[model samples]
Target chain A: MTVAAARVPAASTPSFIGGMSRRAKVIWTRRLVLLGLVVAFEIYARFIGNPRLFSPPSAIVYALFDEILVDPRIRGAIYQAFTEVLVAYVMAIIIGLVVGLSVGWSNFGRRSFYPIVILLYAIPQVILLPLFVLTFGIGPACKIAFGVSHGIFPIIVNVVAGMRNVNALYLRSASSMGASNFDLARHVYFPHMVPSLFAGLRLGMTLTLLGVILAELYVSTGGIGYWTKLYAETFDPAPLFALIAVLAVMAILLNELVRIAERRFTRWRN
Target chain B: MNDQANFTTRSIQVAFLAIMAGVWYGLTKTGAVTPLFLPPMDIVYATFMRLVQTGQFWSAVRVTLFTIAQAWIIAVVAGLLVAYLVTRSRHWTAVMEPLIASTFAIPLTLLFPVFILFFGIGPASKVAYAATYGFFPVALITIAGLNSVDERYLRAAKSMGASSFDTFRHVLFPAAFPVILTGLRVSFFISFASVLGGETLSSAAGVGKAISLAAELMEPARMYAWIVFVIITAVSLNFIVSAIENRRREY
Candidate 1:
């Protein structure tokens, strides 16, 4: 009878309160902290902060749905930015792969050209923003070119690094077995490149986003830059905050896409 | 064989550069590309010489350097403080490190407009933006550096009757110095780039502003001149930094 009573009491305790693993608890704590920050900001903005410069979370959300999304002009600008990023990313991958392969395929190519590539990469690309504008004009073309310039370097550098590190033993054994150069490349070089190339893709996405946005903001006469400039000048912080939040979300989603692709493609490494 | 290979690579690089110069000169001199698109080399050189002699050039450079210095100071102080605090406990590290890293993954440039809203289009805005941008690398690297110190060193120091402060000072700091130095170098360049970017976007003064202004005025020669100056400075700075790092590694 005593054992039955104890079991009943133990079973009566709430499972929800007792079931969390340590990681889940930590994750919940982080979420709660973030929520707490949002709440704090909401309170400060509503009561204490300057309305012209700071808008509460609720107002920003409302503005997002009502003002920014519903407007056709703003929508087109966002679309243009998205398209620019996509095109630039594709171009960067193609060009970076070509350059990287050509320059990293042989000892002569690596030694002769890699230093020059690094030198070009070291320059502050922002310093050339104006030059880009002058060369391509202040259109989507300028933004796309700038994005490619920024994104291509990381990919090339990483591809070269990856291709250089193939095991000498593997190469010698394969060649001794009468493998052709094409066979060697397919069997050895390609496998080694997957992980490093993915890493570069992730970085390339980030830099491409940065380059496109920098061009967008610098041109201030059209696209997202114009809208941001207008909102800032007019001191309409709600729509302004909403627009920026949208861009941030888009960037995060793109980055996540690259990361997922990296994981999916590089599983052989494990 | 290795020496010959080295000589061949060196000559190839030299030849490649010579050919590029030749092509550029040939294209411009022949007017195959318009002067508006690619100014003559002599014109750009003369423009750069004239720009260097101007007081406006010096002031613009001064402003940019000053902004970079300010941003760097802010980033270092805040980054070290946060890193030290967060490293006080493993739980803190677990909670904060991912938060910092994920936030950094989002191009912080998206927030540049917000910065302008609050700080306006002055050096103040650029300072805040650059400092915020730079803080991430400093904090992340410092946290890693501090956490990576060998536990055996700490134990040895403790067994020798060393106090906690002494243990940290003698055993921990030196071991972590190289990584922390790398973090500082990275942060410096980040600050430099961010400040330049901010000025380029919307600023009243700085080298970036000068470049943009030249572009707006359709003064291609002047703009190219400013660009060449910046490229030289940036390249030289990179070399200087690597030299310093090599020296540190030797010791």
Candidate 2:
């Protein structure tokens, strides 16, 4: 902090002022356009685009309460998707943590399984949503399964990575003090792994949402996906837009929760 | 920390692949599971060869890759422009970075139907969605990477009589290049997934469509074959990018 602040002294010399610009002005000038672009887009969307292509913000806004909130089934499906996501996320954490530790903690296990994990992670899991629905049945189970598959890999990878580079010195020193196995794990390994676990959680949250949303859309038999398909097929963008906005709000809140948790848990780390 | 032997790491990786292939073969060959449910390794290999030989696979792949390429190009250009605009200030990166990041967290799969409705079932929809999905990470990373560059380098170049353009060309570009490249790699892979997604949802043709068609047609072996091909392709791209990235850091 001091070093960075020291540079500020030379931040406003005549020569500095000659070419230097105010950071505040630069920040505002760039950010001011965000509102401008939205205003311009609102104008274009509301006035120029095909009504089917986009609703004017006013129409879309009206649809949120009039069409979406008024429909009990749509509301139910939205809630169902939310619950499925929450459950799937918890399941993914448990499975990923166990699997990651099992493989990563042993050289032999790591050699056998990490390859499979990486290979599966690379492939686009969304492509298999239909098959997942077919196999797991076209219900929340399939969506939850798909979501777990997407969510678990990032967690496993991050957890394993966090364990791999535990400076041997810490382990050695702990053991020298006659620390028991559980004590060693608690005092050394757990603290070392905390930051990376939170990092994985952030990624896991994003992927879990993607997985659930993909499965939901693919099922076309039940849940939010069913409603989205209905709206699209019937050429009703109002309800479709409204339902999606609700989902977006859910996603934002979930992501924010994870972010807050990450901050709370990983506060000691750099 | 003990530096593990390179040969040991190499063998571990190789051994991992061997065991995986063994399990895959064992699962299918013993007839414990139905062939359609879990096709034999030889059968899948045969299907792969047939698909590749007949060139039925290329058309779908070409379309999918083309969509990804187009979207990535659009995203890179737009994201770089926006990021450069954002890097003009510190506070802008702070406020707008979160805004962009939060907007990006939305599944975006929700917007797929909207894209399909607007653009019709075509590559255009695929391109738009893929670009929209890829654009966020690119812009976010570019701004972060550029902002994180050391100020002394900029000042040093300025004191040496370099103009802003020269400073950017010589100092800023090189420093930010590695992080920006990583962003491109991330975006490209994401764009690939999203393009596949758009095509699967509604498209004239693409690899995703191939998978969907295969599944509905009940051709499990062929579906497995195509999926295996995509998995290989994705893994290889990741390997190549990581290799290039690792190599770049040395120079």
Candidate 3:
């Protein structure tokens, strides 16, 4: 298996120049394909497609700043949603790290509680959205709580796995050097866990975004959800598309931030 | 010492669960937490039993299950076809894999409005929304699986003058099966969650809708019951998928 894996890149890399040019060509083709899709959508939306159901990209872009951003309430809602995600994510990291360490540090703790944690993680927490609203009320609190709930599990699971997966050889060597528990953790286990923890952070971010948005959409009395619901109900596709576009951009930026952090922290892996 | 440690841990696990149930019971009984927020355990159980006996519960479950089934089917077909096409060339794989993965980062739930506009506020909307949301993971994982197929195996197959179809069947398919199965499991749960989320957001039918309705009507017990049912379903699905994967590994 290892030989086969090594042979793959060797076979593929022989025509490095050809590969580079082919990759460049493919990148251009991909861009053109996306442009072509947009042009097609524009033409269809302008002619055949119902304006209420579909909006051209040009119109959507125009509405993004003109109609959506111009509305102060809508802007506030978007800002609020962003804040909720940020706050929830930070909280998730802290809580998840603490819980993960507590649960994963000892073999007995892991054996006793890890299965229960996994069981909780398996449950679709979306089912508890209403319950969250009932408990936290229809405010940013509910959304933040939901996001934290969704985000924390992945971090905890990954951290526990990371702690358990530290090389036994490394531990033995560290102890042979008369390293203390803290030294072993700081120099060996912590570095080893960085990559996995970042993986969890990425997943946790996605789930946090999902949870926050799901709650926001459910409680459509205010927030970005209200604007989306309003536009959809009023059959206003342009503004709705524009609003969704802004949120999509926000989600992408947030994910990219996490990705950048992951790259920075996991540099030693290379 | 190890045996004593094991016994202590086992006892701790049981005690943890018991204490949780006890706190819940005590809170509701003493009115420390309102029944509206945390219904009494007995009331929740009674409601669960009653819901199971009702045709309404079954119908809601059926709607949700049917929507998930349709969404999963569409996601699998479309995802595999796209993934297979993308993996045909290394260049295409390089260009498309990141495209699919980056899109997965964007909360596709944000596009539920577009789905609602297109499909209306029915199970159709939920199906469309879920299938789109579920498509990314499936397609991305399938691409990864197909890309990871050992080139040596393909080369050997070609050296033997094997047909492309035979090479794919004998070499590629078996190698990709486990990853693709994992993708399928993930997609199934994605579909399930998205369907429930759609129903909760806008739909007039399904288990999620039922839960929302119960909550809106202040029927806390019924709401708890519905939530419990969904949790059980999710847990059971996880177990079933894990069991199947475990059994397959034995082969």
Instruction: Compare the candidates by DockQ and give the number of the best one.
Output: 3
Error in Å for residue A114 of model 2:
4.3
Instruction: State every prediction's TM-score relative to the real structure.
Output: 0.93, 0.88, 0.93
Cα RMSD for candidate 3? 4.1
lDDT of 3 by residue, B33-148 (tens): 88878999999999899889999989999999999999999999999889888887777777677677777778898999889988999999999999997887678777778878
The better candidate by TM-score, 1 or 2, is 1
| Ranking of predictions according to DockQ | 3, 2, 1
Estimate the overall C-alpha local distance difference test score of candidate 1.
0.86
A-chain TM-score of every model: 0.89, 0.85, 0.90
In TM-score terms, candidate 3 sits at 0.93
Candidate 3 lDDT by residue in tens digits, A1-270: 111111122112112246567867867977987899999999999999988899999999999989989989989999999999999999999999989878987788899899788878888787888889999999999999999999898888888888998888898999999999889878888898897787778878988998899999999899988889889999999999999999999999999899889889988779
Better of 2 and 3 by DockQ: 3
Q: Which ten residues in a row have the lowest lDDT in candidate 1 chain B?
A: B88-97
Task: Give the alpha carbon lDDT tens digit for every residue of A1-270 in model 2.
Answer: 011111111111111232335645545654676778767767887779777776666677788999888889888999999998999999999999989888777665676567667767777777776578658888789889999999998888878878776787888898899999778667887789887777777778878999999888877777887888888877788778878888998998998898789778788775
Docking class of 2: acceptable
Q: Write the per-residue lDDT of candidate 2 for residues B1-251, one digit (tens) a residue.
A: 22454466667778777887888788888877677666888888999889998767888889898999999999999888888877765555554665666666678888998987877788999999999988877787777678778999999999999987798789887899877876777788889989988777667899988988888788888888988888788888878876787787787
Candidate 1 docking quality: incorrect, acceptable, medium or high: acceptable
